[model samples]
Target chain A: MKKRAVAYLFILPAALVLGIFMFYPLAYSFMISFTQWDLSATRTYVGLSNYRALIVSPDFWNSVLYTVYYVLGVLPVSLVIGLGLALLLRDSSMRGVGFFRTIYFMPVVTSPIAAAMGFSWIFHTQLGYANHLIDSFGGEPVNWLTNYNGIFQLLFDRFGVELPRVLQGPSVALTVIILLGIWQNIGYATVVYLAGLQGIPQTYYEAARIDGANWGKSFRRITLPLLSPTTLFLLVMFTILSFQVFGPVQVMTPQGGPLQTTSVIVFRLYQQAFAFYRFGYASAMAFLAFSMILIITLMQLKYIERRVHYD
Target chain B: MTKRHVTLAIKYAVLAAGAIIMLFPFYWALSTSFKELRDIYFEPYGMFPTNPTFSNYISVFSKAPFGRYLLNSLVVAAGTTFLQLVTACLSAYAFARMRFRGREIIFFLFLATMMIPQQILMIPQYLVVMRLGMGDTYQGLILPYAATAVSIFFLRQFFRTIPKDFEDAAIIDGCGPLRILRYVFIPLSKPALATISIFVFMWSWNNYFWPLLIVDSTEMRTIQLGLALFRTEGGIQWGEFMAGTVISTLPILILYFIAQKQFVKGITLTGMKG
Candidate 1:
């Protein structure tokens, strides 16, 4: 009994903090999702109304679409680039690999707000280096962040082929944010993948080489399968994280860009709650976003847990 | 050179190109921060500043309480880190070493909190903080984050790896459970402790959304919030904006560079475990 008392004491402070902040807030948020409160009045219970409104609202749905687009745009590109960088740098004979690794990981350590400012300046239409580079190359300056044209649509139009609006793909504004997302995350994925690659034993590669396998063959036969677990982990992590994209949008395009194209789910939640003061409605939106993330993560974990080889 | 050596050279070239792409923004930010407004307008893409000046940084300090924001950030971050370490150490020890009723369930519940994204908790937490009159207060920011699930999980994992013999030896020396934790576990888990400290400190220092919600007054604003205010308050003043960014980023950059290895280890440790 005394030993049990001591153990409980050890966990007391943590439990207190968690209870007050995490558990209580979560429960409170869920309850608030069903009520109508405008920060100045008594809460009036309107069960399912907030969720129903969120479901039917075009703004809410557009934010959802934007969130999905962001995940799709950022996740795979980051994974491929990260893996490629990891492969290039995994060679111990590369003398300056450590220096490059540190350089690459610099943005990962820096605050997103700061990184977003840099991106905002770099993609600034009037004074941006991007436009300068284009102008120097004898091409017209592109409205990188403000242009709402779909990149593919623009490319097809250049060749005199017009595509439908639905098939136009991600907007130019969203693409800039997507590119920033890739830049911010690729270094982290590369570092993790590099660690994963280092953990793979050398004998497999050497044996493959002895058996007349080329670089490509050995990579396909040995490296790909060995790195699948890391890849899956990165895929799920990046998916969840991309869903929470806010800082860049908040900093770069405070008004959600030309047509509200970059108003991702979390950013929308922030706007609705803080900007519009629709706390109850925003709470509902928050719950829905949370549900989607929880469901996706749980489903992925269940499906991928068996495939991830510990060794 | 042989074909193999040529391929190695190509690899280095590729890595170097990627490094430049990764680092160009920092280069540009630094250049813009130091360049005069005329230089900025004339050569936005210049490799080097033609005329370097500290006027932008000077304006940043004169415009806002940037130094006060930095001090507030330092206090919140250090306080949060310190409290998190104490709580995480105690709780993780109990979860890892002690055998009691509801241990597994309690630990599982704590672990489950990691799955709940902060977005979902933001509104309610803001309300609770406001209701409790802790809005714009240090305790509101520090106390909530002091029981971080990631830190506790990390510390617990580390504690489980410490051999039983060390604790057995400590017990033989008439040390109580607290003493055993203090004398035996903590000293051995220095690396893990340092890892969590850096993680928590950096996180608190760079926090945006929570601080944005909680802080309404200029005196209570964090460095990140201050930077956000700078962005909006100044109208397209790229030099001072970038200068403020440099100020916000430099301290974390220096801390990261000084403890680069430990930071990498901490990230990889969590990354691989996940």
Candidate 2:
């Protein structure tokens, strides 16, 4: 009993935190989600109406697609780059590998909102340095955010040789945000890969070299296969983080402006709850995003665990 | 070339290019923030200015309550880190060494809550704050973060690695839990505490959404949110925007510099291999 009391003391602070901070809010959000509550409305229970509206709303659906794009656009690109760096920098023989590793990891620690603000300037269509390069090549300055329609059509057609005139993909504004997302997050994946790489005993690679296993074969035969667990964890975490991406959209591309092309699900959720004062609908939208993330993380974990070599 | 040398070259080449792409924004922000309006506006590709100016940094301060925002960020970040360490240490020490009923289940529950990505809680958390009338208050912003699952879990893991003999000695000396915590456990776990401190500081400082929901007062806005407000000041103040970016990112970068060696070692040692 005395030992149990001591153990209970250890767990006390965390339990108290969850009670007041987590569960209370969870119950609070659930209660708020089923009502006619807005900034001025009464808190009367309205059954499934907010969920119904969310299903029918085009804005909600736009966010759904935008949410999908968040996964496709940022996740794979960052992972490939991160894994590639991991392979390069993990080698002890590589000069300046530590310097390069620090540089890549720097952005992950930088504020995402600040990074987005800086990117907004970079992708600024008129009088931005990015467009200035294009102008030097005898091309007109393009409004990256304003050209959202053209981006989708252009991307689907295997990228545009000539910029098209249809709204699609992530808008120029959205692209800048995506770029910031990619930059801030790639460091995390890279570090994970580096850690995994470090875990692989030097003997394996040395043994491969002794048997005349070439670099390409050694990497394919040894490194890639061994690094599966770290890669899996990265994928799962990335999926979760990507879905909850809200701050950049809120701060960097507030209002999802330039025709609402950047209306990601979390942004949409915020707008619904706070801006539109549709608390119920916002809660439902939040749940929808939560469910999508949960399903995706589980799927990735299961799929990757099959190939993960624990030893 | 031997296969080893060839692969090494490819590896370094890819890493160099990748690192450049990752860091270009910082350079761009610095260069643009110093250029005159005409230079950034007309020349656009002005990577460097003939005469760099401090006007952007000046304008950033003049434009808003930037200094207060910085203070607010520091207070919140410092408070969160301090509180998280305290909570994490106490709880983690118990989890690491205590014999108690229902301990595993409760710790698992805390871990489970972490898996529930925070967006799901945003609205509800906001409502609770609203009901409690903590909107726009620094305490409102700092209080919830006093306990974080990740920090606790990491701390507990580290505490487990410390030799149990230390605890046995403390107990022999008639030292209670808190005394052992202060003198023995704390000194022994300085590494774990430092690692968690940097992490908690970084996350608390960069955290935007909760601060956005609760801290509507410009006086209490964090540097991250203050930078956002600076951007909304109705002008394309590229100079100041970059200046503000620099201001917001500097603390996190500094924290990284000081504790990074310990931070990296902690990550590797903790089996956070992910």
Calculate DockQ per candidate and list them. Answer: 0.66, 0.62
Among all candidates shown, the one with the greatest TM-score: 1
The CA lDDT at A104 in model 1 is 82
The C-alpha TM-scores of every prediction are 0.97, 0.93
Top DockQ model: 1
Model 2 segments more than 4 A misplaced? A1-3, A39-41, A150-152, A155-168, B1-13, B263-274
> What CA RMSD would you report for each candidate?
1.9, 3.1
* Model 1 chain A poorest ten-residue lDDT run: A162-171
